[model samples]
Target: LEVRQCLNHMTDIFDLIDAGVSPGRFDLAREKLKKKFGEDAAILRMLEGDARWIELWIAVANTVKHPKKTERIVVNDLRLLPDRRIQLPTWQLFHSTRCLDAPQALLESADIVIQNLLGLFENLFVVVIDQVLPALPSGLQWVLDDIPEAERDPKCPQRYLLSIGMRNARHA
Candidate 1:
């Protein structure tokens, strides 16, 4: 459930990026983005390359959001195999639409999804700096500062400070 929420939140971010309709709808946001940016856009190409995994995640998230009796994530389930081997307690997600030969471990899957999203965000940040930032109108422009390695958060090394004009530059 939490994983689904996180993915949905990402869609919200996408909607914000579009600055258009579809507040929390991933499908609409994705389509609008492609239409606005064109298929050849770097951001769109990046998403296109990761389409498979993204679809799998969407399926998993959807399964949790609208759960059916047989198609539900199994949390910390332990199983005994036919050969009497013990399977450790593990989070698993299974749905027929996105069938896995074996159940996918949820923790690892969630970690992968998050890491991929973060990587995509990092790439998008570069696009913003190179393409979007320069196009901003005058006073609306923000000053961007890259945090020093030693001062940056370990988990989020790409952290930067953005302030509007010199008045707030002292904070950075």
Candidate 2:
């Protein structure tokens, strides 16, 4: 029941956010989306962390609703193009999406909020892994380490912070 209400609220909020996004008002849209997704995720976790139906339905619904886009950012294969047509790397694209260019004030506030959030979770991941290690099998023992580094679990908050800055570096 709680999960249902949360999902319905998230759906409505996302709709309003989509309607709000545009070239001129992208910052506003991003702020709203960031807040909505952050709160919604935490609430969703609390409400339905054990619901198999919600899990299956969300996975199916994600696939149906957001058809994946295979974006290719390759440099011009045509030999006629200039250097300005240079391929924009994924990291660059990710950084550019941030509101850093908006203003200095916005950037400072963002830094403060991010720092505070980090402080709230300081080293808790280490504790979680330590607690789980004894209960896990030797074969599956790598789950703790692999989990911290592997493909971001969509439902995880740590995965959310795996930035584009570290993404390519990690692969390299």
Best candidate, lDDT-wise? 1
Most TM-score-accurate candidate:
1
Off by over 4 Å in 2: 1-107, 119-122, 145-157, 160-172
Q: Give the Å shift of residue 157 in candidate 2.
A: 6.3
Give candidate 1's error at residue 132 in angstroms: 3.6
Alpha-carbon RMSD, candidate 2: 17.7
**Candidate 1 local Cα displacement, residue 159, angstroms:** 5.1
lDDT of 2 by residue, 1-172 (tens): 2323333333333242242333223234335545655545432343233233334333333433544443211222323337556332211111211212222333443355444334323332332233333443333323223235367565653532311222223332
State candidate 2's TM-score: 0.21
> How does residue 12 of candidate 1 score in lDDT?
44
Summarize candidate 1's per-residue lDDT along 1-172 as a digit string, tens digits.
4545555565544534543444335456557777887778776676667667767777777887799987877776778989999766566667887766465565676678778877656655655455444455544556667677799788767656766664434543
